[model samples]
Target: MFAVIRTGGKQYVVKPGDRIKVEKLEANVGDTIEISEVLLVNKEGEVKLGNPVVEGAKVVASVVDHAKGPKVIVFKKRAKKGYKRKKGHRQLITTIEIKEIL
Candidate 1:
């Protein structure tokens, strides 16, 4: 089965055993977390879509590791004024493996 779940202000489509990186979550590796904001679920052609979220539906996942997303650079410059600025950032992320959709 596959499910659409919301976490970290984003939505992801996942299935059992699938691994994905999501915005940082306060959990350690090997910890199991339940995503209760399930938007949709499909099982053997049977589908369930939530109005906002499916009532009583959840996706179970296990934290694989903590990670950091690729660095992003921001540069700014002003014409003849001789002004320039540069910045870089890396977003914190978490890797989780989908265990089941229920």
Candidate 2:
């Protein structure tokens, strides 16, 4: 079965045993997290969709690790004025392994 869940202001379609990286969450490795914001679920050719979220439906996942995305560089310059600016950023991320859908 597969389910659509929302996390970190994003939506992800995930199945059992799937590993996905999401925005940082307050959990450690091996910790179980329940994603209750299930938007949709499909099983055995049947589908269930919620108006906002499905009640009593949840996607269970285990924290795999904490990570950071690749750095993104921002550069700005003005011609002739000799003005320049450079910045870089990396987003914090968490990897979770889907354990079950309930």
Clashing pairs in 2: none
TM-score of 2: 0.92
Encode model 2's per-residue lDDT on 35-86: one tens digit a residue.
Answer: 9999999987899998999888999999999999999999999999999999
TM-score of each: 0.95, 0.92
Which ranges in model 2 have alpha carbons more than 4 Å from their true place?
none
Give the clashing pairs for model 1: none
Q: Best-fitting candidate, measured by TM-score?
A: 1
lDDT of each: 0.96, 0.96
- Model 1 shows how many backbone clashes? 0
User: What does the lDDT read for residue 94 in candidate 2?
Assistant: 98
RMSD of 1: 0.8
What lDDT tens digits, residue by residue, belong to model 1 across residues 1-102? 899999999999999999999999999899999999999999899999999999999999999999899999999999999999999999999999999999
Best by lDDT: 2
